[model samples]
Target: MGIDGGIGRLPLAVADAVRTGGGEIRTGAPVRELRRTADGWTVVTDGEVLRADAVVVAAPAPAAARLLAADSPAASAELATVDYASMALITMAFRRDDVASLADGSGFLVPPVDGRTIKAATFSSRKWGWLRDAAPDLFVLRTSIGRFEDEEHLKRDDADLVGMSLADLGAATGLDARPVATRVSRWDGGLPQYPVGHLERVARIRAEVAKLPGLRVCGAVYDGVGIPACIGSARTAADELLTATLAAGAVGGERE
Candidate 1:
């Protein structure tokens, strides 16, 4: 789900859950290297080195491609084949009095024919109950950044993008007030496009990666890019790694 930046506390909730589960999550730690050692896999991030029996890489496709290209050429080639769309989120927040036409349901999705700046808009306050209470004076409007047909629209600067999005939102919701606040975030190579035969490509990648006993890749690029899909891929990768480890141990026991 695309968060409208209204539910500011949701990340805190997620962090608390991780803390409660005794899982330490680190931010700003960039992985520099992943190499196989005699014992297991070594991950070097920043100046810190960590060892694990298995690795599940869930980074974006381009970055993941660079990481795996040297170690597993076939998997890297598959990653390279996957395509992504560049996107930007233009959010404008207005007061309730500013947009009377904004209805109670989710905002509109502009069909390809609309020839408009926004691909979709979610009425932030109306779509989620938690968001409604988060900002009383604020009504959030999220406008999609880029479309397959409209590549030039994404070339605009933040100010231009924000203005275009506001114009579209105003037309759709009949809002006139200048937004109290506007923010734009560009996500380069963000949304993965699931082209025809994408499943076959992903299956081939998985088969190649399976040759590397402890290596796993999981992310929105594979399966589906939805929240559930990412979570499911992560879970499946973990399970597969565990199964492989156990099977290796069983084989070692038999040999012993």
Candidate 2:
């Protein structure tokens, strides 16, 4: 399931929750490395090194590999093996009456064998009731282009991408009207590919990450790339971290 309205407000919502819980949000802190300290972990950023009780490496595969290189070469190597795919989405808004009949359905996914440029299309206003209610006069739809190995078209400029999407859309669904407003968004190296033995690879990565007492890894790289899957994996990692921390604290209390 997708987020209602949209996911643009997600960061702000998370920030609000953090502030409500008395947590400070740090911006412009680009982490450079992860260092295991005696107390916990040291997060080396562009500006400073902050100590933490536990750390979660939720970055993309290449970046996560870079951060974990010194601490766990094995995990770094495994992460390095993860390949990424790029995609561009063309979101266009047309007059509701213009494409009234054409968008009756939720849109369709094009078959690769059909030699189509567009991988899939979503009738945004039709599929999402909230979007329809928000802007009933406008018919919003989006088309996604590019795949794991078929990203040559992605290098084209936004206009070219939009043109390509329109051409494919016309051929597939007979949409000939020009959009009133259009936007093109590119997600470069946004999706990780899972080849054969992916589960085993994830297991190996998790095992290596577990070697660090208070360190855990979670993201689209370790689990499915969908938002729900990423969230679920993160929750699981957090639960494990909390359990381990409480156990260690109990042991320390007994020792004292």
Clashing pairs in 2: none
Candidate 2 residue-wise lDDT, 41-151, digit = tens: 888888776777788888999999999999899999999999999999999999999996694689899989999889999999888888999999999999999999999
In model 1, what are the clashing residue pairs, if there are any? none
**What would the TM-scores of all predictions be?**
0.86, 0.94
Please name the candidate that would achieve the greatest lDDT relative to the true structure. Answer: 2
Report the poorest 10 consecutive residues by lDDT, candidate 1. Answer: 247-256
lDDT of each: 0.80, 0.89
> What's the alpha carbon RMSD for model 2?
3.4
> How many clashes in each candidate?
0, 0
